[model samples]
Target: MAEQGPHFLMVGGVPRDWRDKRTVAEAVFNDPLPFLDVESAHTHEVLSSAMAAELVDLGEGIIDVASVRGRNRLLTRAIAGAHYSGVIEI
Candidate 1:
């Protein structure tokens, strides 16, 4: 499916001005974050797959945007980018 509605990028848990999804995806793809163990790989696989498919779920309560930190924030942004691209539904 293709994106719907006006384009906007999710910033700080809120939608902002439109930016190409590809650009956002690239930034997220190369983002560096400290990992301790399995968590890092798991996170990479999940977010990478989402980026590849441009499909993700921004389910309620999954992220506390105001307090999210580290890799969590990057993951959130990835999903948000998908949403903005209309590749993923909210």
Candidate 2:
């Protein structure tokens, strides 16, 4: 049997406070890069950790793309305009 792969997504949203907690909502859709939300039903933490591991410069800070176009631009730069592959947790 083939092993299931991790899902990835270029998430973008505005920072907001909810009951003294931070959250992001009102998400927008990009050009459907790659869909893979199979693990979302299990645990969000696991998903986050996997993404962090894959991302090289995922430092301790909030980087907002705020739009699909912005995310595409970032991806292009991150992968040096190469045909990169990843999944989205949409």
Q: Could you give the C-alpha RMSD of every candidate to the true structure, in order shown?
A: 18.1, 20.3
Q: What is candidate 2's lDDT per residue for 6-75, written digit by digit as tens?
A: 5432355323442237444556787645543333433234333444443445332222332212444553
lDDT of 1 by residue, 29-70 (tens): 475533323234454444455455332333333333331354
| Candidate achieving the largest lDDT | 1
Worst 10 residues of 1 by lDDT: 58-67
Per-residue error for 52 in candidate 1, Å, reads 8.7
Against the true structure, whose TM-score is highest? 1
Candidate 2 residue pairs that clash: 8-87, 8-88
TM-scores for candidates 1 onward, in order: 0.24, 0.20
Candidate 2 yields a Cα-based lDDT of 0.38
Query: In model 1, what lDDT does residue 59 have?
Result: 31
